[model samples]
Target chain A: MTGSAVSATALIWVDGERASALPLPDRGLDFGDGLFETLLLRAGVPQFQHLHLDRLAAGLQRLAFPDCLDRVRNCLQQAAGELQDYPWSALRLTVTRGSAPRGYAAPADARPRVVITAAPLHQDRCQPGAPVALDWAQLHWSSQPLLAGIKHLNRLEQVLVANQLADLPADELVVLDAQGHVCSVSAGNLFMLERGQLLTPALETCGIAGTRRRLVLEQLAPAISIPVAETHISPAQLTAADEVFVCNSIRGLQPVTSLGPRQWHDHSVCRALHEEYVGAMSC
Target chain B: MTGSAVSATALIWVDGERASALPLPDRGLDFGDGLFETLLLRAGVPQFQHLHLDRLAAGLQRLAFPDCLDRVRNCLQQAAGELQDYPWSALRLTVTRGSAPRGYAAPADARPRVVITAAPLHQDRCQPGAPVALDWAQLHWSSQPLLAGIKHLNRLEQVLVANQLADLPADELVVLDAQGHVCSVSAGNLFMLERGQLLTPALETCGIAGTRRRLVLEQLAPAISIPVAETHISPAQLTAADEVFVCNSIRGLQPVTSLGPRQWHDHSVCRALHEEYVGAMSC
Candidate 1:
């Protein structure tokens, strides 16, 4: 499960039409002027889909992209409907500012594009209790308030961090912000249990506001009666925490077994929240 | 000249082959894990070709891209040779970590893809003496030392700034860093002359190191007996400067006539540097 692979029998669609290629001039390819969402498909139905769409809408508005949420929603629904054969699948929906002649100034009459790809997920990779190890990444995320909390395509920082993780002995890397505050993991949101309270990084200046993170903060943790706080967590505090875990849309919840020299065998809080999340996703 | 257009007769190539589309799974679109070089093609020759290629090579190395510099050079040469019919053309060369499975970790056997597009430039838009007006942009750049000088594809900041400029009265906008230090304009390197000395923002923290900027700093300024320095600049320093200008590979040099309420009527330093740059390009 550490290195999940996309199956060869993947399906693709561009603007609701089946296609294997994207236009050469799409701004998504040109400037990374786009947003993307990675969702989990359970029994042919997209889990927490409305939340994903809402996040995409907010990101598009922040990027000043023309209104194309309806088209994107339709594309996602159509793609999901076609993936009914696969019980568990992963969907990646990307919305770009579409093709333009050249230059940064988006054309007044610009049309947005939607690219959706669906691939079957291996059953073994969906285990929520799989413990993982993390190493501190040397690469730090830059703070950009305007782009923070939005899932945009300008992910070179994460790419670099992922590359770093490949050379280390960890399944994931603990990434810090430019100011030396622990922000998140390479691909997901992080939460640490300290003194019976749940705390995650506040994403006002950087990091993505993941849908699963929202689910945990708004629904799962609250249902379990855990006090949650979105605040800054220092490296020392994280290392000294009672328990730690990371979560994302596809991987509901994963307990952090080891981070550097620190190790934790107990995951009671992570288990409770993950159980609540699984129950919520089922409905 | 402010909004130069790419002519309808544009030619494109992918991976050294003539094509108008890219494979859907390319990482350049997925993660913006790529580098780009925009060059001015004159008489079938790419102006400042060595400089541009050098910058691209440095960027690719920084991004840990596969060794594809030789391949990129061949593709660029082939594209330029076919554009001999057009006297003045603009060539955009983009190199992306080619297609791969759905993951942030780059594959060891990754193949790089190069996409080059050439379009004839309007003769009128090449005027280097065109004085442009500017306004301070509300958007600020994030400081990422690892990616500061590389011309990578994560350009959403510039896209947003371009959108802001479209709504404003200025032709360009002054963009600062998170620390409120002057960085550059929306699309080019900025330089200012204050008290008979030349000053430009250092690229160690942010901003792309433009090839034309190198020409101005290394050769043109030295030849004309103008002292130059690359250091951090502030908004007050910019507004109080004797003159200001911007430069990129496509646009040789452009003087700023006014910024907000501040005005610059004397273009002696800018004119001298532009003349020297033109002479160098002609050779």
Candidate 2:
């Protein structure tokens, strides 16, 4: 329905009411003064509700918003329900320290506000045997532990790169961190093989630790190798890698065919992860 | 007065109309997907309105957001109005890609949502002139052009850092970009001098260009050097520098007395800027 009536609303919680209006100033909007999660749902139940909630809680704790998570969970439950037909939907859970009086000092006494919205999930290309091509982007990620690894709201880098790439024919671009090490894809995490061992860039300092990415590690029994990064990664390490794949919950384990000058087609670990992701999402 | 409030419905706007809520998922709030201006007002009119507008417009352009600034100015006016005289007040003007679909792509058919909320200005710190001590924060900024100089919504960095700084006695901390250059203090811009010739880091590559920063250069005249840059400014650079100061519209210009062994008892540029800022703001 292009213009044919598709209505939506932010299943909102402000102060104590399910109110659509937020009384705080526009600081939260002015700044991405918040954190959010886009979750997957199958049937009427949230696919990884606990994970999303946990992420939001951790992020709010980092953002220093008073723990108003039960209200947030309540809002999410209200918005999410069994979708008709096939299965799967996306729910976005966001929480800000409401709008503060003004400026950046976190309001000590103001209650937080939470906003959640849901949308139908069209099937993604994530599958067991399907392979995907990838490109390496010129943009380098900056090193910042304060902003790194967490799914906080500040992500203009990804949006800009994604927008630029959407114009090109490539499906995804391998982005490197400021120190010229392979960081990840725009919306997914990266893992590659070096001598038949699972290796992903330890996001201890950059790139978000995706819920599905965590699942790919924990849910599965794959033995992996990750860089013990104190800061940036070197390009020498990436060029030496054997196999490469990118992942996120929405599109699990997509095998890379290319990254900048290099090319690698066969990837068994990627295939295994893809199969595992498909089975998990459906179940 | 939290409980004993004589209530009226919070004024809301969807496409500059009187509406209670946004039916569209605003990408601004969604992906930190927008830009905003928190204008100060004494009477009904916004102080530094043009400067604020310029900054907001430039922010929108840099982020590639579909900007409807006049509509936003109208909304900001609606957000701010006559309230009982308090210490200060703020007019928070926010504009976002009205609503986007359930993806990162900027919606093809979208209406920009402009929300303005009026609130009392909170003075969290007193003795405004007692040069606020700053700590060199553990936080580091990442490199990204799409978000470098614009006050876009991806403020989780600020949010996360603000939380950390709250526990400290210092008013704020200076943040370093990943590459070791001094970016900006949280919510303000920085200026340093090596041998009397003014030098500011190039923000074209990163850091928000504060409206007040531009005003400082404009008022300082005599072609005082103001370069947009990213350089590894060693702590030695501050100690060796002849003068240092920080400025934003709200704070005006505050002299930097001590930053990592750099001391300036009475800096002339800072004093001049302070007078000019206060004089201009009073008018």
Candidate maximizing lDDT: 1
Instruction: Give candidate 1 misplaced runs (Cα > 4 Å).
Output: A1-10, A124-126, B1-10, B124-126
Which 10 consecutive residues of model 1 chain B have the lowest summed lDDT? B1-10
- B51-108 in candidate 1: lDDT tens per residue? 9999998998999988999999999999887876667888999999998888899989
Query: How displaced is residue B212 in candidate 2, in Å?
Result: 1.9
**TM-score between model 1 and native:** 0.96
Error of 1 at B225 (Å): 2.1
User: If you assessed candidate 2 against the hidden native complex, which CAPRI class would it receive?
Assistant: acceptable
Top candidate when judged by TM-score against the true structure:
1
> B111 in model 1: Cα distance from truth in Å?
0.7
True contacts kept of each: 0.88, 0.64
Top-DockQ structure, candidate number: 1
